[model samples]
Target: MQNQTETYMRRALELAKRGAGHVSPNPMVGCVIVKDGRIIGEGWHEYCGGLHAERNALKNCTEDPAGADLYVTLEPCCHWGRTPPCTDAILEKRIGRVFVGCLDANPLVAGKGAQILRDAGIPVETGICEDECRRLNEVFFHYITNKTPYVVLKYAMTLDGKIAAYTGDSRWVTGEAARRHVHETRAQLSGIMVGVGTVLTDDPLLTCRIEGGRNPYRIICDSHARTPLDCQLIRTAHEIDTVIAVTEWNERAAALKKAGAHLVLCQAKNDKVDLTDLMHQLGAHGLDSILLEGGAELAFAALEAGIVHKVQAYIAPKLIGGAAAKTPLGGTGFAKMADAMPLKNVTVTPLGEDFLIEGVL
Candidate 1:
């Protein structure tokens, strides 16, 4: 029974990953129902405000769902949104046993889903293949627990740890493969954010150049009036949508609004923009995960605030040795080694000539 449960859990995790970008406001959930040691049905949540995992699984079932054992990647949602509570659906299906991979972290659903099933006189088991399930929905879990979006820090740098050469002429530091990977990352996120410094220096379009999915929201963090009006990011409306975040005191916010950019005025802390408040605002706007594409100062601020949850470094094999050539975050560096953040479960992969390193914060 344990091995069968593991197999179903693994399959559910695979399906959940496929629904990453599409499932927003709703955590990606996968479900499978088996009876008499035979697989009966399988389903995954495909989009926001859609049928939940249990309902999809039941829909796929050809035979009577009664007495079946249901296995779900995450705890079934208990609250009503666009769809009915999944706990009620499970009860109505008369599933004899339920095996949940991980508990839903949303305050509204957390333990309530499991409790609902239990109260319905159905057998309930949770935390099956727990680690894998939690990892699959890390973004959702982070948001629910921390009240902020999970920040994925992504950047490209040379072997010598430089993002650009001495002159900051960093048109393209990484190879085609790494750049394409960045696009893929952008596509997965609800939004991609950069500092005004990066806008001034690179004037990047900041859109998903990749082919798979829709472009994410492009966000720029500018405080004290740094982003220039003539920046290409403002001029182009090609593939992506753009939003500019400025402090309430910035006189340039109105101009940016006039230029057809979504402007968010947030509070500043210690002369720097308050990223925490910015993240909550994005969350309220239904963005659960954000990719922080950097220039150093923004990355450092996010890192210092303990808001960055993942870091992806694309390391190219070249040396541009100098203080000026070093990577952006390395500029001011961490204030102290004690302040240096630690990451766990680091994974490194090679993407063409560059290396992709990712880890949890």
Candidate 2:
């Protein structure tokens, strides 16, 4: 019975992921209604302001959900915001038992949803695959708990740690497989961040470029607002979302706005844009997560700011050794190996010829 419950909860988690890149500031939730050891209905959060998973599952069921068991990835929300309390729906549906993957980290519903069910005399069991469920909504949890955006630092470098050649030709550092995975990641996050230097040097479009995948909000961390009006991002700003983050507004910032870019001023420290301030601004603007695709300097600043939550480093098998070549991170690095930052929950994957190392910072 325990193994079967885990299997059902795993299915719920998979369904929850179907809402990836669509719901932000709201956790992805999936619900299943089961009766007599058979699945009756399954549903997941579809969008930001649409129906929630529990209510959708109750409404989608073919057979009678009354006196049946209900499983949900996250605790059903008990407060009224965009919709009424999900507890009301669960009670009305007459669910005999409830299985929850994890209690919500949201202060509003922390344990109230389960308490409500318990008060109504339904057996509610939580913490089924609890760790997996919590990690699945890390972005939403971080936003609710810290009121800041979760940042992931992503970069491609040679085996020798060089991000680019001596001439700064960084194109195709990783293989086609790794590039495809990057596009997939861009689709999952709410924002894709890069320094203005990356725009000027690579002239990258920064779009998802994958079929049926939506492009994230393109954010350029330009201290002086030096993003070119002719850049592809500026050209397509009207069609796709683009933001220019700057420390001070100038004529060039006005020109970029006139060219259809949205300009935001961030706090400055040490004569440069403060990455922490930039992250808070992004969070307040409704971006729950940011993928920091960088030009070494920005990556280092993000790390130094202590705002980077995850790292994705794609290491090519070939070596490009040169003192003049750029590495994944630059600026005043830690003076000693003992003072360097460490990662947890690290995993290494082989992407064609390149190796992708991912870890929590």
Candidate 1 lDDT, tens digit per residue, 1-361? 6897899888877877777778875688888888888778988998887788789889999788899999899998888888989888888889999999988888888889999889888888899999888888888888777766788998888888888888867868889989888888777788899998878777887777766676888889987666677887777633357788777755677777667678877888877679888988988887878999887888888887778889998888888788756465843666688977788999889999889888888
* Whole-model lDDT per candidate: 0.83, 0.91
| TM-score per candidate, chains pooled | 0.91, 0.96
Give one digit per residue, the lDDT tens place, for model 2 in 1-361.
8998988899999999999878777899998889999999999998888899998889899988999999999999999999899999999989999999999888899999999999999999999988889889988889888888889999999999888889877787999999999998898899899999999988878899788787999999999988888889999999999999888989999999998888889889888888888888888888888899987888998898999999999989998888999888988899999989999989899999999999998
Candidate 1: Cα lDDT at 234? 71
Candidate 1 off by > 4 Å? 237-240, 248-251, 335-338
lDDT of 2 at 52: 95
- Candidate 2 local lDDT, residue 123: 99
For candidate 1, the lDDT comes to 0.83
Lowest summed lDDT window (length 10), candidate 1: 324-333
> Could you report the Cα RMSD, in angstroms, for every candidate shown?
2.3, 1.4
State in Å the error of residue 123, model 2: 0.6
State in Å the error of residue 360, model 1.
2.0
